[model samples]
Structures are given as structure tokens and as C-alpha cells.
Target: MRFVQVAQHADDLKRAAAFYAALFDVEPAALFDPPGLLFFDVGGVRLLLEKGAPSSLLYFEVADLHGTVAALRSRGVKIVQDPQLIYTHDDNTLGPSNSEEWMAFIEDSESNTVGLVSHTLAAGD
Candidate 1:
């Protein structure tokens, strides 16, 4: 099975759409005028934007979580959670023992909790 579409709710269609456009670096694939739904193609996955508050968090994979968060911060994106180690591996996953997983979060214009994450095989302090 494959996941084709995921949705997020936003009270302000224009603001949310702008934010997503800036984030994805592309205009929405389709826009519905009446209910004000905007859809963006995210690496083959369809991200549907609708009206209301987001029901859950959306985590976007990033090559550099810290750098991405910093860049987004400079662009006026609200960072709810700073970059930090969210998990660590004891076995050899990325490197030897002590490999870490990092994550950070930002609140979207539509009050959605969006996250950025990175996983590497390097040992962390």
C-alpha cells in the first residue's frame, strides 16, 4: 500500500497557502474556490490544505535540521521546538553506538505544528 494524500487544516487559506508555497518552493497543484482547499505535490505525496485547525503534526525530512530551522527562523517562521536530540541508537545504525536523531518544530501560519528532522550515522556528544 502507498500513501497518496495527507491533509492539514488552516483557517486562513491565503496565509497558509503562501507559507506552504514558500516552504515547498512551488505553487499549489490545485485550488478549490468554494471550500478553499489548496493542494501541493510534496515529492509525489499530495498535501491537501483545507479549512480549520490541523488535526496532527507534520514532520518534514531535512538534510540539516539545525540549518533548515535557522533559515526558516530568519524567514519569520515561528519555531515552537528548537533542534535537539529526540532519539539515540545503541546499536550500529548510522555509526557506532550513540548515534542520534534530531528534530525541531515550527508553527505554521495556520497554527499547525510542523517539524523538521534529520537522521545520520554520526556519533553525537
Candidate 2:
């Protein structure tokens, strides 16, 4: 079955909401306080930010890894690891053939490590 929702810890909902909104470039789909829950529709998956949920390391695919990292850095977002080529997809098993997979890590507002990924055409491809 496909993922319906993913939960992430957020001590302060407002702070987390603002951070996520900037990163995702979209407003949250829903918020339910009192019980303290906020949700964002991430590619049809519900990203639930909750007060009691444990922190999760989430990975998101972006069209431009470097550009996204730069924009985030300019906004004082902590870059845990700079973007770098992670792997070359020689075959179509994990990704498109003759493509390069790049990845970078950053710290979310709540201090959870988040991974950003991108795939680009390999040299001479």
C-alpha cells in the first residue's frame, strides 16, 4: 500500500508551519490544534506535524538541488551537508539509466535532519 501520511515531531506548530511553508512553497492544507496537529499535502501524501510525534528524517525530491539549497541557506536554513553526487544510475533499477543522483542534508526548523534529492543526466548522456 502507498503511504497515506507521515508524522513528524514539532514542539512549536507555528514555527514548524512557517518553515515548512517556505520550503514547500505552499500553505498547509489543514491544522487541528487542541490535540495539536498540522498537515501539509506533500505530493498527495499527508505530512502530519504533531506535538507528540517522534522526529523523522524525511527525503524530498526537488528539480534543482543546488538552487533549493542556496535559497534555503540565504534564509538562514542550516545546511547539514552540501549537495554532492551520490550515485550514478548505470541501469534503470533504482533510477533512470545514465543519470546521476545528488543529495544534500539540511536541518528543519524543529532540528530534524531532512534530505533533499535530485537526479540529473550523467555526463555525455
lDDT of each: 0.83, 0.96
Q: What TM-score goes with each of the models?
A: 0.84, 0.97
What is candidate 1's lDDT per residue for 1-125, written digit by digit as tens? 99899989878778988999988778989988786888899889999888853566888887888888888999999999999987787877653466677889899988789988887665635
Model 2 lDDT on a 0 to 1 scale: 0.96
Model 1: lDDT of residue 63: 82
Residue 68 local lDDT, model 1: 85
Provide C-alpha RMSD values for all models, in order. Answer: 3.1, 0.8
After superposition, candidate 1 runs with Cα above 4 Å error: 52-54, 90-99
